[model samples]
Target: MRGGEKCLEVFCEIFPEADLFTLLHVPGSVSPVIEGRRVVTSFLQRFPGVERRYRHLLPLMPAAVRLLGLGGYDFILSSSHCVAKAARGGPGAYHLCYCYTPMRYAWSAYEAYFGGDRLRGAARWVVPPVMKALRRWDAGTSAGVGEFIAISHTVAGRIRSCYGREAEVIYPPVDTDLYHPAGEPGDYYLLVSAFAPYKRVDLAAEAFTRLGRPLKVAGTGQDFERVRALGGPNVEFLGWQDDAALARLYAGCRAFVFPGEEDFGITPLEAQACGRPVIAYGAGGALETVVGLNPEEVTFPAGFQPPAGEEPTGLFFTRPDAEGLAQAVLRFEAEEAKFRPEAARRQALRFGRERFKEQARRRFVEGFERHQEKTAARRTGDR
Candidate 1:
């Protein structure tokens, strides 16, 4: 399930009457309660190939969303990964979009998403109309929403750039307290990620193969076979793991290798909560999370060169290449003690679920009350 679904659950718990709306739904795929709620969709939800060609379908979303959202509801909280933020609002309703990023297709990762990499060429040829329409609608409906709740500072920047809107950053919640320290490191390295093209799981597999280190990959996606084909010696692919198994892996791994440049990676925080150090790419949210090895305070392992300007949380490799990632892992093994369990715990606390809930509740409630007052004033004036 997408992170948006989890956010929606929170929204539902807090506001039971709040209905769930989206572009599409795969029946029997999501919770019945969520599915049973008042249903609405963008017309693209009915398009034959819309799911397969989502990037192209994105442009259709604003029109489709507005079809359901226009002048409806008292409050709209969209757990958006796409143009759900474009949902229109009624007079008194507060549209609070929990934005993942300002739609990656039109912005920062546009080329990576549509630049003939894989389906980009076919999609480009096939869905020009939909893509164009979605872009226009995306821009138009963005003006409809009242407030935005960005999942991360990284995404907040994208939101501002793409929508010319200000957003409050509220990092997504992770159940860190439920995960425990295993107290022993397993011989294997761990990687858990949705197998999206941008995730770069190939890098982790390649690096593991090169280093001849034991690696266990957990998760499923279109790139599953491609990633498995690279597996050799010590690399193992274990389809999708449940929460228990995943938590155990986090607690057991020598280190968690997160190669992707995510908006805000929850897995890294999960691993840190488990008291394992992470080996992450230097850019994106990892820049804020992972700290690097220090030659002064700790021993530098051979074949590991520290990146310039790295802190002490975990090691950061600038390049996404297998060699660079492998070298960082090797170095982390050498200077593992420098990144203490307490330090890892401290980093996880920075994105604690309690903190996220507290911040979001305060911000949303304040915004909602302000909207409530404005609505009262408008009614009085009308009278």
Candidate 2:
């Protein structure tokens, strides 16, 4: 599962009895926790071959979301990265949307999802108008939601910019217990990610290839073939691995590479939980997660000196390119001894499942109370 599905699993644990509404669901694709719930899929689920080719059906998502009747539920919690946030609830129901982002494809990430190479032929012409319409609809639907909760400060900024609405930030959960270190570091570096255009997996593959170091990439997606072609003999593509295999890989790697700009990246935290230092692009959620040496703190004439009692867990490269990543790897090797495994593991513990659950409970209670107060005030004004 990706970050969004992992979030859905946590929601399932919180509201086991709540009905799940989604565009489509592939049976056995998600965790048992999510699958066990009474999943209420949209009209999109009835279409043949929708499971594998869902991206092709993006144009119809708004209509499909509207078709889902949420009137029966008194309280609605939508785990949304897309049209799920636009689901209409009953008139009296309180709706809270856990917004992953305000539709990346329809907004600033248009080129990443529908650029010249990504979308060809008639699609090139067709998609732009559809996305423009989707953007308008997305902004209009923001009023339907009573409150918004963002997964990260990064996403909260986007929500504010795109919809003109402020949102509370709640960092998502990571299962630290499942990713404990084995106390043995392996020779190879690691990258567990999907081969999407925006993920920048190709950059890591190219960097490792140029350096002639082993880089094990463990996940598959639409751009897998393109990413594989860019890699040399040093880069290994290990298509989607099971939890056992992923855990082993995490525990053994010298360092984890995260080249993508994510909403709230979970894989880096997972790697940190396994006591592995990370080499990440200095952007997005990585800015919040990774503790790196600051250039501003160093005096030029004094030269590089390790901070007393500070154990850095990762290194960051300002640019998201092969040369930048290659330099970062070389820098990490030079200061490799300063990064303690225990310190990385300690940092990962801060975003554990229990912390998320407690925070979520408090937010839900407070939001519900605010909703009631507003409703009571409206009634009094009418009198």
Candidate 3:
């Protein structure tokens, strides 16, 4: 019920289920968009101070999922970033989990979650034991799910590593059609991100200040004050923006600077759909989504910094550092023409909403049908 809420917003639209199951909810805490829908929380409902230390509530998750009757549903889809993937399903039921990443707090960013950062430090002092207990619960509960749909190949790799389970990569959806190319380039580079430690917006601010390029950042989070404090003359931080405003920014921007090494960056695709070229860390969905221009032909590399002349659909920083990002931004402006509106549009087409829906439908139906066939064969043999 945090950043994973964004992915849940997309999945709920696609599948359109009747009842939504979750661990907890703070009314009006999440966006009003999900109101009126029946959200069934786990047994930890109204537990004293649970919302504040909710990550600690992980131990209760298995018990909560077990409380959900798998036998009662025709299809059980879990929009998970964590153990929501671990929800059990009966033999005939189909459990489709849209995984964000295999538990960031445990696998990848363990130190960061418990590191000397203010929040982590506070968590350590207050809820270290609970966090430890939940991690153990999370590992055990992961074995319950029937199938996993990863949001990115990076996440699919994590799924393999943590659960010893394979997952199909389904790039998260963006409203491409809604974010058409503005056709008029603005004077500034743009950033649309929540101020999280992992996002590394500090690098962007530093680079823009050094290079003397105007940068406008949109979105807000816990790190907002720190991020703003780091900003120099050329950087402007706009707290948060609506879709219309964000689309306008995407449309008119010279380029979209995405500093984070995201699992799958919806923002970059959104920028490309608006015919603005992306400057992203070369990793995760950027590998599959953005085509690097090389002289020989267009090729998609697995991580950042593709071979030159690859159509410049987007420029990738060699790594996630200020200097690398600055150089990439400079290179993007120098070779910006190669990233034509038509080419950006063409690349964005691969991640269109319709394509994603069709793929999901095919996979879900195919998997469910196969399960049915296997069940039928087993029953017939027994008879």
Q: Which stretches of candidate 3 lie over 4 Å from their true place?
A: 1-17, 26-36, 43-71, 90-93, 116-136, 294-310
**Tens digit of per-residue lDDT, candidate 1, span 199-223:** 8899999989988989999999878
Ranking by TM-score: 2, 1, 3
Residue 376 C-alpha lDDT in model 1: 88
Using all chains and alpha carbons, the TM-scores for the candidates as numbered come to 0.85, 0.94, 0.84
lDDT of each: 0.74, 0.86, 0.74
Question: Which digits, one per residue and each the tens of the lDDT, describe model 3 over residues 224-313?
Answer: 898898888789998888888988999999988888767777888888889888888776656666765532332342223433444557
lDDT of 3: 0.74
For residue 10, give model 2's deviation from the true position in Å: 2.1
| Greater-TM-score candidate between 1 and 2 | 2
What's the count of clashing pairs in each model shown? 5, 0, 7
Model 1 TM-score, 2 decimals: 0.85
Off by over 4 Å in 2: 295-310
- lDDT by residue (tens digit), candidate 2, 247-313: 8999999999998888878999999999999998877777667777654432221111333455688
Instruction: Candidate 3: give the clashing pairs.
Output: 282-304, 292-310, 293-309, 293-310, 293-311, 294-309, 294-310
